[model samples]
Target: MSALWRRSDLVRATGGSAHGAWQDVSGVVIDSRAAGPGDLFVALHGPNHDAHAFVGQALAAGAAAALVDRADDHPSLAGLPVDAALLRVADTLKGLERIGVAARARSRARIAAVTGSVGKTSTKEALRHVLAARAATHASAASHNNHWGVPLSLARLPAAARYGVFELGMNHAGEIAALVATVRPHVALITTIAPAHLAFLGSIEAIADAKAEIFDGLEPGGVAVLPADSPQFERLRARAAAAGATIVTFGRSATADCRLLHAVSDLSGSDLSVRLHGRMIDLRIGTPGEHGIANALAVLATVEALGADPVQAGRSLAEVAPAAGRGARVPIRLAGGEALLIDDSYNANPVSMAAGLSVLGRASGRKIAVLGDMLELGPEADRMHAGLLEPIDRQDVDLVFTVGRHMQALHDALDAGRRGGHTASSDKMVPLLREMLRPGDTILVKGSLGSRMKVVVEALTDGEAAGVRPQAN
Candidate 1:
């Protein structure tokens, strides 16, 4: 707790009045359960739950103090046993943002902001892994890329950090601009633009525009790492130029500064060679998928832009692993034999769905796709869902189990021989998949977060598929 945040500094940054004995804080936490000794817990009020109600719990969990808006008439204040400091503010969310801004001002870390319709979290994690090898790196934990997540991640930045990686996410326009302004990164990476939030934004072009907003907050003469192979490459390059950023491209495009020279893949992983600004580097990725290789290229571009050794970063790719729910693999012990379960149950869009299918196609076993709806896909949702049939056919998938209303279209479009089953909800589909699975089967479960496809993954892993019955809809 030496210099994370002084009591006077917190007051000045948050524009709040301090009550009780003020003290310095070593950490910042939003969840009471995560609060540790010397931590400053910010009591946030959300729609379903209120963090303010857990102030006492946070203190008991060893939080040094609590940041709350209510002081005089709050119910939680009267029950406090310990004499912990209270930083009272008008609004806790704004206070968190101010603290983030102050933290950015105090640190000299080379910052990078990442945003895209897909792969933001994965690319951010890759950057963290590659950069942390050479410097003190700080990055957003989990998918902390929204308004609250961005500020909270920044507020947690240590003053001595040499690198800071922030993921900026948005479902609509202007959101990325606002989040990136808080980060003000020296480098910005747009993984690839796809149809993610089409329900709100309407078209892929609009989504591309939304993702391009990350460049708005680029520091003067900062670097913009973009996917040269993407259809919206020129549009993104123009936007980056307008934001006064130096453009750096990565992909199979010959002109890209970081270009993929060759990629050889097997059931285990991928062996790849990349040409970074004409310097060739070879590496092995523990994860499978063409997207993984693309993510590696972005990581290399980011590390080089930050003045870190791209060669060292390239070597680190050999040890890179997927974050849970993205593409974490698990071995399922079946009665017949062990099967491979690809847990891509986190979230999905059309672009990511096809990528996951491509990975499943490479498996050294029978391929099964237990898919859920790609949510937030506006008017053309049904068409987009059914369009996945092409990838399924291309992958030579043996069976397909689909869930969610949108995915029903895909199920119906599939050849009757290949269709395992379909249901209106993931709950109903889980039991059917359990019965359908066999030895040497590689199953890929994916969908948007709203689809809750993770339950299917859980049911399989928990070995409840055989015992549980599908509930009547």
Candidate 2:
């Protein structure tokens, strides 16, 4: 593979001075510990900790060069070799953005940007999977869809790629606007609008307004892929129209450009019949839940918008497995037998929490739900937490275990027979969960990232505990 960035190009892009003999870097990385040979380590200064302290460590780990605002002032680079490659800039963050912008400008690839209240990462990944089968595809790694992450992923974009899929995420109103300005994608997709980040943005309408910002940076004649089922559909469509975008929607709604006709879901996956622009196609996604179907529809809509082969894209949907901490199924080796674990512990809101419960309802064992607080709902946090009782009941979950202060509402709301345990934190809930597990049990674990529910997942999978191992879907 060719170098992602050359020394001369880096100098031109960031308007920085380069020192030392290094000529090229194959990748860009912000985390010093993860930096490796042929990687450009960008030392970013954040509120909590300055990565400048780890410059030496990154270089020692074989990074080709280091991007830094302070080369001489930092004590970490005191005894570095005189020939060590260093790119000095006014600000490392802005420098990274410049490199990203440069990458976007020079690439001839058909680019797509995905942003939503939920399913942005999943939809982005699905697009990558579908497009990669057709041509050279580049996408944001993991959930690299923020200020620094967006640019970092963009800067890492290979010039030879035919398609670029980027996931743009935000916690505030203007965040996506700024990030999308850098992306300027030909296809901009919003998975759905939900009450995510309500604590900061205030109302769900405000949240729609914030998410609709993805259209602000659409390239000329760009296509906007939206959810027809969203209550904010017309609001988003109007915003996309205002941005001069060609609108395409996906959902169960008959008016959707890409519409789901029928779906049958089980614990493992789902089989669905969908109509794309009036052409019906059968798709089987390895990921379960109705939400997975919605994500697949969004992916297919993006595929059509990008002018790729729909047949190939539809076929690729079967290979898309659930990402870790996002509904991956794991098999735990209990003393008596094995139990299934649905790992949805990445992040959560009321919509996702309900979807998880619905998936749990499909399982053929004693259904268990281990929930954590859904953060950032603002004043309605308590009501939202307690509202999950409806889905829990609808899904007929046998036992419910909740973590965090906010989830106490759900715990208090559960009937006596269904309430398993409740704790202030995931750590305290681990032991109580272990004692209750039995053979033929299927457990679904979910919560927001702030709740640290992954701790419970780790505890259950630990060798000292249940000795859990992930089983293929």
Candidate 3:
């Protein structure tokens, strides 16, 4: 691999003092355990733990260098080798930000920043997948869209990259503002506005306003890709316009610049007919559900904004598959037959939960939903949990299993026939679910990260199972 940061460039970018003779780093990582040869391990101090304690471990694991703010006299640096390649900065986090800013300033890549209540990671991945098919593309790894994740991802951008996609996430106001300023994307996309982070932002409108912060850091004459179907469309448009962005909207709304004409969804994926600036294109996305279609439209709009071939980008959607814990499907082996598992266990909200249920509703087999509590809904948490019953009934889900205290609302709301079982935690649900699942059953597992719904997914797929298949992108 080509060097991502030479010693001189690293020193200049971060304004740090080099202590040893490491010449170049091929990669950057924050975790010591993830460190590899030629990787620069940045020691970040978090509220829970000080990564400075891991610098010795990172260097011992073959890291090219370690970025640190601590002195040799510091207890954490006690075991670090004297000859260890090191970059000593006043503040490692700020140093990382400086390196990111320097990388962004030097890169020629057309960058797109995505932020929203849901689908931030999926949409970012979609953008990366399509754009990479046309050019050298760089993107934030996983859900690396926070204060440090944004800067770390930016710092990792290769100079040769033609396109860069970034996902920016936030639970409080001003978070995206800070992160976006570092990204300064040429195109800023908001997937959709939903009641995520309601505990922090309070209302859906407040959530929209927090998300609009992505526009504040747009480069000159940047494009703002928005969801026209959202109630906050006008609000987001106003914010984008105020930020001097050229607005591009996508949705089923006729006025959307990238408008959806028709969509056919199934257990596997969706076939979408879309109109982009009066040019109609048909796209087959491997990711299932209407939510996937919405993400695809946002991606197409972003492709257009980035001056890429929309047709080629749309065609690339055929290869896009859902990442694990974000809609990847796995078939589990049973004594009787095989049961399909939809693992949407990464995170959840009212919007995403309903979307998952809708996807489950499309399955041919005995449809089951193993749902956990959607966290961070604030005062309406119970009401929001109970409200899922509407979609559960509408989708005709054959059975439902719920986990967590909040999910108790949905469990109680379910009719006796539909109520499979309810548990206060995921651990309890695992055995019950494993025992109850049978052949030809399509089970959809979903919940917020805090709710630990992945336990149920792991339990189902743990033993005597077929390997996971990418069902949706």
Give the TM-scores of the predictions, in the order they appear.
0.96, 0.97, 0.97
**What digit string (tens of lDDT, one per residue) describes model 1 on residues 122-210?**
99998999899998999999999998999999999999999999999898899998999889999999999888888899888888888
Error of 2 at 380 (Å): 0.7
Q: Which stretches of candidate 2 lie over 4 Å from their true place?
A: 467-473
Q: Write the per-residue lDDT of candidate 2 for residues 1-473, one digit (tens) a residue.
A: 46999899999999999988898999999999899999999999988988888888899998999999855767767777888889999899999999999999999999999999889888899999999999999999999999899999999999999999999998898999999999999999998888889999999899999999999999999999999999999999999999999999999998998999999888788898989987989988988898898999999999999989877898999999998899999887776578888999999999999888989999997999999999999999999999999999899999999999999999899889999999999999987877788778899999999999999888877644553333221
Evaluated at residue 433, the lDDT of candidate 2 is: 79
Report the C-alpha displacement of residue 49, candidate 1, in angstroms: 1.9
The number of the candidate with the highest lDDT is 3
Compared with the true structure, the alpha-carbon lDDT of candidate 3 equals 0.92
Any residue pairs clashing in model 2, and if so which?
Answer: none
Clashing pairs in 3: 287-473, 321-473, 322-472, 322-473
Tens-place lDDT digits, model 3, residues 1-473: 78999999999998889987699999999999999999999999999999999988998899999999846676898777688789999999999999999999999999999999889999999999999999999999999999899999999999999999999999999999999998999999999988888999999999999999999999999999999999999999999999999999999998999999999999889999999998989989999987899999999999999999999999999899988899999988777568899999999999999898889999997899999989999999999999998999899999999999999999989999999899999999876776677778899999999999888888778873333332211
lDDT of 1 at 317: 81
Error of 3 at 228 (Å): 0.5
Question: Where is model 2 poorest over a 10-residue stretch in terms of lDDT?
Answer: 464-473
Which lDDT values do the candidates have, in the order given?
0.89, 0.91, 0.92
What are the per-model numbers of colliding residue pairs? Answer: 0, 0, 4
